[model samples]
Target: MTKKHYPLFLLMMLIFGMMQVKAQTSLNDIKAILQSPYFEKLYSNTYYSLLDRMRKDGFLPESLTGAYEGMYCRTTGAMVSLLIETSRLKEAELNIKCVLDATTQNDMERIPHVIGIKDNKYTIISDEHQIDGQAHVLLAWARLALKRGHTNFEDKTWPLVSAIMKRTCDRTFFQHGWWSVEPGLVRNISFEHSREGRRWDVWDLLTQSFVGAALNDMATVAERRSETKLAADWRKKMEILQQGIRKNLTTVRNSDTTYLEMRLPDSNGGTPYLGMGWVTLSPVAAQWEGLNHQVMRNTVKAMQQGMLKKTNGLAWMPTDSYPDGTVSNEIIGKGQAWEMEFARTEKDYNRIKAILDLIKIVNAPKPVYMEGGWLDGNGHKQSEKISDTDLAAMNNAVWKTKDAGNGEQCAWWCWAMARLRVAAGLPAEPARVK
Candidate 1:
């Protein structure tokens, strides 16, 4: 068997082992996991750190010293919600103000620019032809508007979002069923696939994920405003996009086992990010097979065997691939791993617990306060603060990390996973109880 196939077998065995055992989580159990001092500290630190970064640097960057402002809002919004849910509403409100402040300072709209706040610190480098940033920008706006009940909500963001979505739909890149960044500008500039780069032509899932999230937010906002027609229209659009996602979904097969493929346009016909099998846990995914008993089991089993790091607790980023299927010389896949976890069923509690355990481990030694923490849009660390205390102690402190530019996009992934687990009938976490 090939090297990849070996892991699949082991994963299958792990799943089998689970089948003979009962899931050990109750609602209180899940809530306890969420409220655990370790997990909460990580959540609070990372959420605010990004805000502090934005205030200090004036623009969120994609990394510690990198410049890419287009994608920070979504992460920012995601973290905002996390702050609110965790009873840190005041901090969340402050971060929202910072982003809005930055937007005004930058003269940015829904198609948020990628440069810095003053004197063009760096030219924004993107294909200059796609909508992940645009979608994320809208997602952030809608999230803030909805959560805060901002009086100027429509007057403030609707126009920008409307124009951007209209432009996005008009793009040939998106119109073409595959949904890609425009070709011929710069390979890997955005998540577009083209022959220009010698790199493997892998489709980026974040684009779709962001778009899906934005649509959901838009629909939610429309519904709240009692704009039934608008809500219905947006919901239909989301459904269409989601349906397309399902129709195109495919899995990678190695020998007798299969792993979910992270990117598409499967340029090499090989599963590069085998670790992405968890993404399928997206409850709202168009092609979700989560309702089926066996399929759910398969996913739970996959988590047990394939992605769970035996020693670290942190989940792997897609298989071994970097951004795309490109053979990176650098081991970019390594890190403390953030708070995101996949949830296909309540039965998958063990997997969730494992993720929480890892969060404890990663945050234990260097936990910071719940203040503005920063990680890029994808939730990897930037130059965020790190202290000497263990994760438990850090839970009570406020972080002051520079904004990595991604505000809450990182938090949204974890938030969605948590909600999904609850939706799957997982019990409430114990700690959330009054």
Candidate 2:
């Protein structure tokens, strides 16, 4: 590198060095990424109109009182808060109140394990549910209450968070931050391929990452505002969780990109999402926003090739799954569009731009407004829309292209879009795909 390029090279080296430290989750890097104009514009525009569409579709009723709607309590709640963050508080408030009232009615039902059935109330906490589902609910309420200075909401939300954590500790096995649940017997599944002697626990990556993040966010908020008495304890717990995540879920760094673990290290040497990058945005965002920003950035860059865009122009981790060698597979990799966008670093903005351009060209994957929210995929490969509306919405969504013949653009996608738009400083021009 030339003398003039020395600073850039050195900066990259410094970020890599930081990721090697003991506590590897970098909160600061995430914050810096979020602050970038590219992210702001992309996120804001993507999310701005999504809330309006969600409200219109009855997915979010004005009643402010309802049931659990399956394990989607978290997605629903998180979307509401994201909407509010992007200046859609009126809509967000309605959704938040609905969740609160629903949870308040039958607190017992809202625990985890409430999957597949949307009774509008709540479900049971079993092995089937992703832990992050519950965490999302807690985070949604906590963020809203804290931001709005609502003491009562904070009070209510904290207990729920604590209860969930305590229950998680009670039900699952936690040793040195490594958690494993006894499948089938514990819930009901074949634990055919667990760690030999260990319980046949189907470790879901999304839950681990999100649960850790939700706790950390809660802790950070607590430390900042000290809104709840549990802030200190929560913060300590968060530190423990972070340590455990790093220990058990050691980051897989390849070339210049990094990825979190989904399952225990497999010998195949392919990506083991096990749900790792499913919520990659959270930890990365936390690191950037938290004190350890540099660590987060370096960690990402060091592992996964730093978010590559295909020659055909789609932002996704390069894999051999597709005939063209681009599509990200859910079973093998869960190569979704949001991951491509969210994983973009400052060094990889061009790649992100290419992917965004493809999305626009396709016109934003239609069937835009549905009963629940965004549809899951563009190709409808996982077309369980009516049966698994939450899953569909959780995975699908876009800005300009709604009807790409895949499925409806849903809430989770909307949330992703809004966040990206906000980061990019773009106009929040709402477009429909259906």
- All candidates: TM-score: 0.56, 0.57
Best by TM-score: 2
Which window of ten consecutive residues has the lowest lDDT sum in model 1? 327-336
- Where does candidate 1 stray beyond 4 Å? 1-71, 84-110, 113-115, 119-130, 144-150, 176-189, 192-203, 220-233, 252-304, 309-341, 344-347, 369-434
Candidate number achieving the greatest lDDT relative to the actual structure: 1
Model 1, position 405, has a per-residue lDDT of: 25
Candidate 2 stretches greater than 4 Å from native: 1-71, 107-109, 112-128, 155-158, 168-205, 220-229, 251-259, 265-282, 285-347, 363-409, 427-434
Candidate 2 lDDT tens digits, 353-374: 4544544433333322221212
Model 1, span 306-396: residue lDDT tens = 4332222234222222233222111111111222333433445555565555434433544432112222222223332222122223333
